[model samples]
Target: MAHPRQADLAGLIDALQAEGVEFIVVGGASAVLHGALAMTQDLDVVHRLTPENVARLATVLEGLDAFVREPAQRRLRPQAAHLSSGGQLNLLTSLGPLDLLGRLHDGRGYDELLAHSEVLTDGIHQVRVVDLPTLIEIKTTAGRAKDRIVVPMLLALLRERERH
Candidate 1:
């Protein structure tokens, strides 16, 4: 079955876009795009969060009463399975549990997120999405128990890519 979450991801992108949080879909959803994994619950986005990005988001979320603040904790690794704040879903800065790609690219091993993202239709709106190569990076970086279930599928496709 096509991942149900894929459909909803557009909405999440719209929400963040409305909030002025410029982010790319870079987690599980990214994996799905690259055939590295399947559906997911929470939407994982990589925001630039540069001073300008932060300021823009502040203005957008402020109107909705939704707040954007630095997520507590510093270091983040894909290997972690749970959020420190106790929730399956959350927004992260530089924290683990989101399986955020360190660097991203379109084809090859991990690089930078920008390297492996593409734009997709987010409902009526268009949004950027992470490409497959980056999805593999996130999976490798995250290295979680669940990842074991996904790795085989990714490897099968990756090996095919290597052949040519």
Candidate 2:
């Protein structure tokens, strides 16, 4: 069977939603959803790690042919046990680079982020994307150069959202 293009992030989102995986689209993708002009090669998601939710996530990962993205361990397939234990999973998948985060830098989980998220459509499924302000917080806390570059843009988007 054919697979989605490597850059087809929306296809991954649609699949995750279909599998009932509880996740919040965050990082650069969330910023883009809120109207920021930015480009990201990966989809960053914070997922709920409840055993049931992790099971659903594993099912999706299996369908996507997901495996660890790290160079040395790229062949290792994701297992439910590992996903359920949950920290961060950076996987190169048939769909794309899917970053599954179990907790935020500040230790917030999926439920917390979901409480503050909005459902945004990927031209297919209504995906839960983290709010702009929260996205900014995550980026700032992370303090990576790439994230720093986008902080101002996210702040501007937040302001723009507030004014409208």
Candidate 3:
């Protein structure tokens, strides 16, 4: 198997927006932007998976390369949408190895995605990103090792919020 590379940088997010493919910017990249997390090479995002959006994203990504799906296992994962380009990217999310890999966890949709989002601008294009507090909530709910770090930091921030 090949190592995963980062997907959806600011520039690419901008580009994806232009293409009209809806995605939410989440994980460490968004956390860094929100001043609650450090920099990250990988990018994670969640989208409202409807039959239409799924078909649209697949068509859009098909122009790039093949899309792959992995079987479900003992992991808090989501459906994934990946670019087949070997030198390019492999988007890993709660969404899984393919966008429509499995039903979304509790069928979380665009509204939930929007509820916890922060907007970021890269030049003229803007992207919606998941903010720190919500990211901590989402990641902690997922309960991954990397996400475990979000707990203490978030607790500190919450304490700080209360102190003020």
lDDT of each: 0.50, 0.83, 0.53
lDDT of 3 by residue, 46-125 (tens): 64555656555555444434333233233322223322111123433321222321212444545666776778664675
TM-score of each: 0.55, 0.90, 0.60
Give the per-residue lDDT digits (tens) of candidate 2, residues 1-164.
23332447778888998999989999888887788898988888999989889989989999888888876243788888778655888888888788888888788888888878888875756878987777888899999999999999988878887899
Model 3 steric clash pairs: 77-94, 78-94, 78-95, 78-96, 79-95, 79-96, 80-95, 80-98, 80-99
Among the numbered candidates, top lDDT falls to 2
Give the RMSD in angstroms, all C-alphas superposed, for model 2. 2.3
Worst 10 residues of 1 by lDDT: 77-86
The TM-score of candidate 1 is 0.55
**For model 2, which pairs clash?**
none
